[model samples]
Target chain A: MRGMPVFALGCALALLLAVSAFSDEPARAAGFAWETDYAVALQRAKDEGKPIFLEFR
Target chain B: MRITDLTVVDIGLFDFDADVTLYCFVLNADEQVYLRYGGRDDTSPDAYLNEKSLHAALEKGLDLHGKWKAGELKLPARPAAKKPADYPSVKSEVIDRKQCVHCHHTGSGKTKLAASKGTLDKLKDLWVYPDAANLGLELDADTGITVAKVKGVAKEAGFKAKDEIVKVTGNAVYTWGDLQQRLHEVPHDATSLKFTVRRKGAETELEVTLPEWWRATRIERRSFVHAAEPFPEFWGRELTEDERRKYGVKPGEFGAEVTKFWVKTNAQSAGVQVGDIIYEVDGTRSAPYTGHPALWVRLNRKTGDTIKVKVLRGDKNLEFSFKLRAKAW
Candidate 1:
């Protein structure tokens, strides 16, 4: 139906908004980032060729 | 909904990591599970029987309380409770985000959690960005990001510094402090540092040189600056067991926990009770905490060795005064 394109566009916009909302930096400027078993993700990001935005939750 | 897919985010190092110990646990939207904190060196049977490994599907995890049961995970001896919490309050559990439509539904035993394990509750506060290279920044450690100051302002690649820039000039920046902040907000063709830095007494305009841009697949963690004027605001949403299933936020791994209280291994009667979460060390609004229990009873760092811990023990955030090494029973 013609509604498919409109629906897809809506979904795309929602996804974009979701990604942006989650892309915040936890102003850890003065403190230290908690270290953990994050080495694997670091390695994977390397493999996938993506810019790993390291954020501390 | 069926809280699904728990996994590990990443393992990272921070500035205080030089001698400090700090860790975090992250889970998706749903799946509230139980986590027991044990050490790698605790040679007692308590470590094993206490459910040391990651236990996903914690809805099924509680059943493993006694006798070494299913999977790689072992259950710890259940402690005698004042009252059996069959329907435990789930009070201390951390919720970062909510569940979505794709999540499956279930009933008690099979009853699905109210949320999904796909998303992060406080997505703004949690996550680990994958790394681009083994060592993302390939600069000489001693000299740092290797700056080669240039003349004109090349294309300032905001914080999105992935690929190397052609119109390059200075060194590679490790921290997003002043120099990088200026380059980001000012203009791409920046000739000098035109930003003010708040130091001890006054705001000074320091000149920071930008080196040629080097691009690599570096990993950045998704972290939020939780205004912890007092750090208690940053607890709760630690890595849960279900989360361990997906992002590998390893369960029972002793990533990071509140320092209840540290009784010197030798201090028979230091008059300090357990259950105190440290708030401050010496006077500097407590820094990233190392996993040592009796840490406050020791020296702080290279300079301020003596430490005094300010912690919250339930109703009161008491102040415990103790000096490192030079302590008496």
Candidate 2:
């Protein structure tokens, strides 16, 4: 029964990694944690009263 | 690295020039662009961009944002916008899949639509990427606000060093991004611009007339059909006189020496290699209306048109015949 619980945890970990690997978001740069969603970034900019540094590469 | 902890977004519906490989825009929440931070030439990215320059652009963006918040500056309205899904190539995705299209493919899709309309010439200088240097106004790369020097149109208008441009074409320009936006709205046939400058705390206005061919753009910085093969998948410069003589070509002959070739294209499939000299296509000696021979092919040929090409590879005179196709992105 304990082994079953550990196996479930392993499956969950693998699923999480698989989902992350398939994410469309690019790898984060060294200093900035770039927001992949444009709407979210725009809203955040408005809330923080900040300008957005948008990059297209 | 200096842009750390700032709000950075990786995607948007913004329509950029086709040739822009990478670009940065600093803008407020209301979508008022402050300035642009990227430009490149045929040879290298170093011509218009570097780490120091980008840092300068970031700082300028922040300064402008602060000024805008403090009511010291007012930004102009953005130009007419277009959605990526409106493009024919990606319409299906926008309608059926209901997903945001990839930013990189936007240019390609737009080009495809132009090709379909047989109006590829419209693609020439399409969405000309503007820079302050085009007007002879060199901004400080670190601050991106103060005009370090002026030349060309800016100089002819009596602009002096350290003169801060407060407005361009009647639009408030707090940073290079704002200036670029105003310039982008300039019609291709526009022959003049008006500027408001703040010099020594005194405001003055000046008008500068642009020379004809101001719309002429650098071919390398444009996005158009490039992979229409038997056109080589490469970029080259006009062959030198000595190079023509060494290849046994007569004087006044037209040819270009290959400098770079793209991988996995028909050029590679047909065994075209770098350093090959392309002299003729379809028995035409050389009609290089465009500086680059490949662009000439693109403007003249259509998809599936089989063309005969003559390439001088080292000491061997080689020939290639291939059909043109749409670029594979």
Best by TM-score: 2
**Per-model TM-score on C-alpha atoms:** 0.22, 0.63
User: Scoring each candidate complex against the real one, what DockQ results?
Assistant: 0.04, 0.19
Interface RMSD of 2: 14.7
lDDT of 1 by residue, B1-329 (tens): 11111122111111111110111111111111122111111122121111112112121223322112234433223333321112111111211233211101111101112112323222111111111111122211122122223222222311122222211123222221212221333343444443232334443343434332311111111112121011221122233456334433233332223423233422113333543344455565422222222332221232124345555555565665533332222
What's the lDDT of the predicted structure labeled candidate 2?
Answer: 0.59
* Interface Cα root-mean-square deviation for all models: 18.2, 14.7
User: Tens digits of per-residue lDDT for model 2 on A1-57?
Assistant: 011111111221211111111012324212224465667766877877778777655
Residue-level lDDT tens digits of model 2 in B26-49: 777887777766544334443445
lDDT of each: 0.24, 0.59
User: What's the lDDT for residue B96 in model 1?
Assistant: 23
When just chain B is superposed on the true chain B, each candidate scores a TM-score of 0.23, 0.64
